[model samples]
Target: MSDKAKIAVDAMGGDHAPQMVIEGLAAARVLYPGVRFVIFGDENVLRPMLASFPELDAASDLVHTDEVVTSDCKPSQALRRSRQSSMGLALQAVKDGEADVAVSAGNTGALMALAKFILRTMPGIERPALVAPVPTLRGESVMLDLGANVECDTRNLVEFAVMGAAYARTVLGLSRPTVALLNVGVEELKGKETLREAADILKQASHIPMEFVGFTEGDAIGAGAVDVVVADGFTGNIALKTAEGTARFMGELLRRAFGSSLLAKIGYLFARRGLRQLREHLDPNNHNGGVFLGLNGLVVKSHGGASAEGFKTAVITAIDMVEADLIRLISADLPDVPGHEEEAGAA
Candidate 1:
């Protein structure tokens, strides 16, 4: 444990919980041998899984807990029960300085709610935003506020830009990322007052001189002209799901076309490898994970539909983020945010 990057994982937090998590962690261990994990969940069930793979004990340490935080449980209930819940325990490990990062695929709402309460937002943060990488025409692009805070104000949007820019710079290795406001249109008079206000703020904000390239429509996201797209969680979530559905739809349609006749089959035979690569490039399953930013500590969220591969991906993301010291970089760029600043004379 002392020899690796420690990450606290909720063993029973996903849809397939112990089964998928253990499998994914096992596979990931091959690629990331130096990464250590702290598993938190019902020892009774998880212990048997660990026994099935003798290698499990060698890979991770189990922070045993009996209670499980279900997807339907209220945030408050989960937090109250967290004293003994797996997700709670995993998170507590990070708060206690025992782990460098935390990962979970449990109830996103509850997870975000509890994270805000327990970890608290950064000094300049108004609300924590969900940030994820999306497939793009050029390569990949980053987007933010993907359902963490469904409702947001202008100030919150500005903070999202600051954080997103920082993440793009530090994690994505963009020197000065081209930031864009996810809006209905590109013209200056396109969106509502809310977007207008947010756009204006990004234009003048010096926290990070992100290339604030104005608005971007749904179609433009795939073009990849922008590095980060900032929007309210409600809008961002809708766009994300819509993009996933469209990618799947296109794949099926192409497959159906290629399977039509002997002539079509021959063409597909030669193009099969490229087609598969294209499908993989666009598959949401490949990147079905994200991080909740703006908090003092690192917290990542995995898709509920995630397999072991997806869970492993989330863990890998959290490890890189913690190692890069991303939050500290963002803090260096923000204004005197409400929660970020220290009290003057102890208030």
Candidate 2:
């Protein structure tokens, strides 16, 4: 066993797997030359696919299993019946110390359920928050509860903030990350009681290792108003999808406008470089992984429809998290919370 980071992959998890999984790993191998992989899936399907990429074959070890968690599988169903499935096995590898992290492009609910069950929660975290980096004008910012908890209490929001700030410090290299709660408006009295109460607590909290910027409006997420944006899953999910849709809509409009006339085509040629930069900056594939924060081991959820390049980005993300010692950092930060001792002991 190599001492370096080893990622466990649910080889049959994605929409285009196992091909996309193998191809993505092959691409990732080029970027993370020293990293190793342990692929979990049917040997018959994965072996043939693995042969196509010699580099991946050289860097990987295959574990055969015929079971798979379908995209429509319910979390409860998966937990009760599919414990040996590809997604389940990948997380199991993490628990068994066979891999440093697990990556799956599987059912989000199923993945989250299995990971939480297998890895368990960190001492002070009530629930794991789904977090990812969002592209913004100032730069990328970390946002959490992407779809993990549809409803959150004040404590959950505070914990999410702590986790997000730690993530920002690790990935964005920020020393003291600024955190903000997403609200209807930026004022103290403009939002619901849940949001306001959370804001009040954050504002009053001390020695938490983050600057709690009062509140941020929806429009400010892409403006990069804060390093970490915290919201309940219901609101966060809508915001995430809306932002994705808007990015695609804008790209489509640009394409149509640029192709409408000869003059526009000429303009497009002149603007191609800048447009390419914009495309790269906004590409969902570049930020394809949603990490399950609060799990004992790292688990990155890749988009179900992600392409090979997208999956590679997820792999690289897992590598970065491992190098950052994200779990340890979160543990260290959790102690500063006022009610953390009671909550942690209860869990």
Q: Candidate 1: where is the Cα deviation over 4 Å?
A: 1-3, 52-56, 207-209, 336-347
Give all candidates' CA lDDT scores.
0.82, 0.91
**Which candidate ranks first by TM-score, i.e. highest?**
2
For model 1, what is the alpha-carbon lDDT of residue 90?
78
Residues forming the 10-long window of minimal summed lDDT in candidate 2: 338-347
Return the lDDT, model 2, position 193.
89
CA error at residue 27 for candidate 2, angstroms = 1.3
Q: What is the C-alpha lDDT profile of model 1 across 1-347, one tens digit per residue?
A: 32378888988887888898888778777777888889998888888888876675677898777788887998778767665678877777888888888899999888887788778887757699999999998788899989988888888887898889888875578888999888889998998788898887778764464788889998888888799999999999999989888988988998899999999999999999999899889866577668889887899898887988888778777777877788888877774334333631232
Structural RMSD, model 2: 1.7
Best by lDDT: 2
Name the 10 consecutive residues with the lowest summed lDDT in model 1: 338-347
